[model samples]
Target chain A: MNSVFWTHLVKDLRIEWRSLDAIVSMLFFAGLVVVLFSLAFDPRAAVSQGIAGGVLCVATMFASVSALNQAWSREIRHQVMDAQRMTPSSGAQLYFAKVLVNFIFVTLVQIALAPFFFVMYNLHIAGPAWVLALILPLGTWALVCNGVFFAALSIRSRNRELLLSLILFPIFIPALLGMVQATTAVLTGDNDPWLWIKMLTGYDIIFTTVSLLLFDVVFHAE
Target chain B: MKKAAFTLFPLITILLMVWGYYQAIYVAPDDALQGYVFRIIYYHVPSASVAFCFFAVSLLGSIGYLAFRRSDPNKAQIADAWALAGAEVGVIFCTVVLTTGPLWGRRAWGIWWTWDARLTTTLVLWLIYMSYLLLRRFAAGPQMQTLAAVLGIFGALDVPIVYMSNRWWRTQHPAPVFGGGEGSGMKDPTMVHALLWNMLAWFCWGMLVLLLRYKVERRHQEYAELEAEEALASAD
Candidate 1:
């Protein structure tokens, strides 16, 4: 079962590598959004330590949606999901695998954007900056888990994006709130990011559990 | 005897509804804070309560359909009908909740709409049910039924989340507007009689709508079967 899961997981990643379209588009989209934000205000004055966190948080949300759309939507659209269903591993395994892949892809895009943002906005670099590292992977994991479920639900619908957003945005309020606050706290050296950290962990656990229990039904849904 | 019993239900329901409305309008205590506009509570609160109840009904119906292949088709169909009716009525009540809530909000808090957690969660609940109804219409056969049932269960899963998240997280919305586990179920003794009666009224109205829809759907099934038979006879 373990081998089967990893094989399936690796297969998804390789397919993504071959295409490269999703990662390229996501990075481009994130950059464009950041640039748009930059242009909206003077980069130096606009980078209100607080707003930088908000921008990245929103960018992460959009970037994950783009990546998940690429990863899940194609498999669903092509009816390859039926093949996945017949695999030896359980639906739970498949869901986690997809989430892992989505987490990595989205986080990498975030890392890529960090330097561009630093250069453009003249963000003051500070200690270790490595703590900011944990935020992206964990935050994107929660957000993409949500996006994957919605994407799966909306795959065959007439208005996919509209339906996806309807289901996706409302449920994500807590995660977004937590991530933005935590990111700001980290950047500005707030004494403790404990509250935001706990919120993110809670969101991740609740949603990951939900996705595991519910994915089989959603994947098999007509 | 069965026909008589059925008839009695509607008759009693009508009487209860009338009596309930009278109490709600004339008897319930006037809140010093909200004045008469708060009277919307009689209809709005009950509608919202029953709406939650209906979502549960739909969830149960969906579970029953999935678990019991041997159950009577009629039972399943009736359950489906009740579920649909409950959801439709639930949506209406939600609208009332949403509408009257803002009215109360504007009067009390001086804001027409605020991103208060409860308001946001309720809005999400409303949208989920709306999508559920649309999914039901678009789905067909056993597959459609299964899909609706799955969606129904998944959708209802959020109700607990909504209620709890408000409790656990930061929310501008106050404690339960109605039955928040205190104040003796009703704010006033007279209001109790009125609110119960109003609830009975809305429930009956919900039943009437359900039965009417069931009849319409039954006829539709019959018409389809007849059309199939006609096509077969014509072929023969």
Candidate 2:
């Protein structure tokens, strides 16, 4: 509804749309994660059903980091942050825009990698598959929301790319647990996936709210 | 007076630590079940308690830093110093928990480690703070304290989630945990006394370290500020 958010979202989308840099690189990186994992774990094993969920989440985590690390690169390169500060709009809008654009790119990459997962792992969802539609996006939001915020937090760090993973992964651990366990539940029909899905949804809400509230503090900091 | 305290506090901490050790090793009755190995609780549990308490201190410091940064910049710096001191000391105690727990476990539980809920949560807490420490180390700028404070809050927020999730995961295939339920066996009064004594000693030691660290950080902060002011003057 706000023009600032839309303007930011549209600008980011147009930039990625024109260049396709983040998407292509992410797809390649995620695809590599899938292929390497398929080789190392041998999806033909009896345990493939159990592990496929973790593999998918791990792939998304790595791929999102690849994009998130540079999500602020475009702004930093041309003194865009200074201009952003001069604007009357709040920093949270800019944060949400970057998160959304990155989320879309990662989701596209996941969609592209879906066929590979299905073919490689022979994944057959035994439980409600539609919950996965709920699960994947929630898990991605958990990663991307924190990922984007931490990316901003570490934007001034010396080894930002490395620092980003270090800070992001540990905080991301709980969500990673929820995502993998929920997926495993859905795929195997062993446990109630609803419990884990709720956990993930709660985590997303809590951290996203924190990020939005703190974005101004981070954005305006000297 | 400050110099006297600086020297006397550490000396007192050392004496208390010695007294605690004597109470733990010589006075406390050894468990009939665990034998001499049961003594590790005096060290292990207290360290964990201190670790957890200091992390809370860090969280308070972080919040204080953020809340005071704009309105009270000087107070914010003090808070930032405490935040760093708390994390560093908490991490050291957590390290004791992780290491000595394994030693106690090897002798008592017959296994070194397990994927149990308490242990996993402790390990994850360690990691989250370790990452926080790393961010403080790697980050270089004016906003480093603000960023680290935000991360500290994030890390603290995750601890409960990690604990609950690990419990759920452990439920699927429950592994052995130290102590049957909440914590290990502390049914005896003498054992509780020993544990209480050691907790006091460790807390004393931890406080001495924490205050010493806070003072050092405050000094460093002042020096850095002075340098910045001088640089500004020279540039002008």
Candidate 3:
């Protein structure tokens, strides 16, 4: 099971690395979202921090969704999932792997956006952008788990994107709420954002477990 | 049998709604703090409660689909239909919650909308239910049912987190208005009665809608199958 999981995981990673389409598109989308938000709000750094948290939440949502749609939809569309299914890998392994890949992609997009956001919004990154580095992984985990599950649903549908947002966004509220609150706290020099961090961590753990148990049904639903 | 069940539902719903209104308006006392407008809580709280009911029902239907361990197409279809019904009804109540919330907000907070906890959580709830319906639409068959079931369950799971995120993080949202009076610091009995009666009425209303939606959805599925068979026959 471990070998089977690793082979499929590596295959997916290699495929993503070679094509890089998902990451590129997500990055572009994230940039566009941030630009659009910046233009609309025209917020100075002082007033921007309040809404900046909201903006980052929205941007991260788009980035995560874009990456997830690409990652899951590509597998389903190309019938790559069939290959994974034929392997001896358990659904949990496959689910985690997908989450892993998506986490990386979303985090990279966030990394790229962080600098741009800093300049454009004059937003200061408290604690050298490293003190808050954990937020990316933590926040993206919640997004990716939900996204992977939705992507599985989308793979079987015609209007994949619309279907994804419709099903995923509503449940996505808490994660968005947490990230925004936490990010805002950090940016505003709140000294601690433990409460918000706990919220995300709790979401990640619960949803990850649920997704693992449910992935077999989702992946093989047809 | 289904039609009779369906027919009986609306009659009871109307009767209950009327009684609920009486209980809310005439029976329930006015509050000292917010007066007549607080009456909106009757509708608002009930709609919120019914939304919770819809989510729980949908989760159960989803779990049934997964745990049944049989390939009964009939069971699968019924489960999906019910899940969809719950989602639609859930969305309706979510809308009610959103609508009534702003009205309440305007009265209490002096603003049309606040970034407060209840408002944010309700908005998230609305989005999640809407997404659940969309996922169902996009996917088909047992897999669709399973995918949606996961969503139903997961969506239900998120409700508490969303509700608490604001309070835990100290965001500007209002704390939970109805907390069963267990150290929530909310001690207005009139408000409590209004919340309960209003919730009951909305639950009835939500059920009525769900029953109607379930029947329509089942028929809609039957019609599609019929059309497909007719096409195959004509081709033959």
Candidate 4:
């Protein structure tokens, strides 16, 4: 299982490395969103400071969706998913690998966008930087876990992109709320970042477990 | 017998609705706080409850569909019909809630909407089910049912989180009027009775809608089966 998982993960990583399709496009989109946000809001205003965290999270969410779509579309396009299913590796293994790859892709895009977000929004992290360090990965993992699952689920649809976004966004509300709140706490030096982080972690665990258990059903349903 | 039962449903529903409305308007005393505007509660609360109930039913149907899909395709077909019916009815009731909520909000809260947890969650719930319906419409082949069932289960899971998030994060939405801990009940017995009657009436109406919608879905499935059979026969 472990070997199968790593092999799948490496396969996805190599594909992305060779094409640079998912990562580059996601980063570019993320950057554009940040720039658009800066243009829309006066960075010097108090409202901008308040909304910076939310805007950054929203941009990341949109970019992650694109990356997820790219990841799954590549599989569907090349018939790689069909090939993977023929392997002895369980659907769970492939799910986890895809989730990990997506998590990494989204997180890298987020990291690339972070500097631009800070510079464009004129944002400063007032809290301990460790708070962000903890929240970023956990938050991204939660988002990608759902993303990868929904991306796969919607892959068979006629309007895959629209269906994926429509289904994914609403289910993502709780996590989005938690991440935005936690990020806000870190940015504004709010006293209770831990509460939001706890919520995000809880959400991450619940969704990851649920999606893993259900992935096989969805994978073979067709 | 089934035809007779179907014929009886509308009569009962109409009677209950008329009685419930009378009780709401004439029997229930004016709310000391919001007065006439609070009457919308009788409609809005019951619609929301029915919506929630239908979604719950849809969840069960989805579970049944998924559980029996492989072993008993017939049972799965019935389950899928139930799920389709429940979701369609649920969405209709949800639309009522969404509409009535804003009207009440505008009159009582002096705003069209607030990002309060319940309102936001309700909106998300509507979107979730709307997505479910869209998926059913657009997704192809035998896998569509299973895929939709999975989404139905996930959407059901979200309701609790949505409710909890609202409870934990206080917003402009008033705290729960029922089951909310501490100081959340009607003072007037007549008002409570009116609310109860309306809730019962709405439940009956919702069930009737579900039954009718289920028949429609069953027939639609049968029609599709016939078409497929005919196509195969002609090809042969």
Number of clashes recorded per candidate: 1, 1, 8, 0
lDDT of 1 by residue, B126-185 (tens): 887887777666545544555566566666766555555444446676566455756434
Task: Evaluate model 2 with DockQ and give the value.
Answer: 0.81
How many clashes does the backbone of model 3 have?
A: 8
Q: Write down the lDDT of every candidate, Cα atoms only.
A: 0.72, 0.89, 0.77, 0.88
Residue A22 error for model 2, in Å? Answer: 1.0
> B8 in model 2: Cα distance from truth in Å?
2.4
In model 1, the runs with Cα more than 4 Å from the true position are A35-54, A76-79, A117-132, A184-193, B1-17, B69-84, B137-141, B177-187, B210-236
Cα deviation in Å at residue B183, candidate 1? 7.4
- Per-residue lDDT over A33-80 for candidate 4, one digit per residue giving the tens place of the 0 to 100 score: 888877887568567768998988898898888888886788776688
Question: Who is ahead in lDDT, 1 or 2?
Answer: 2
TM-score of chain A of 2: 0.97
Residue A194 local lDDT, model 2: 88
Instruction: State the TM-score of candidate 4 restricted to chain B.
Output: 0.95
lDDT of 2: 0.89
Worst 10 residues of 3 chain B by lDDT: B178-187
Clashing pairs in 1: B20-B197
DockQ of each model vs. true complex: 0.28, 0.81, 0.71, 0.82
| Candidate 2 chain B: 10-residue stretch with minimal lDDT | B171-180
In candidate 2, how many Å is residue B13 off?
Answer: 1.3
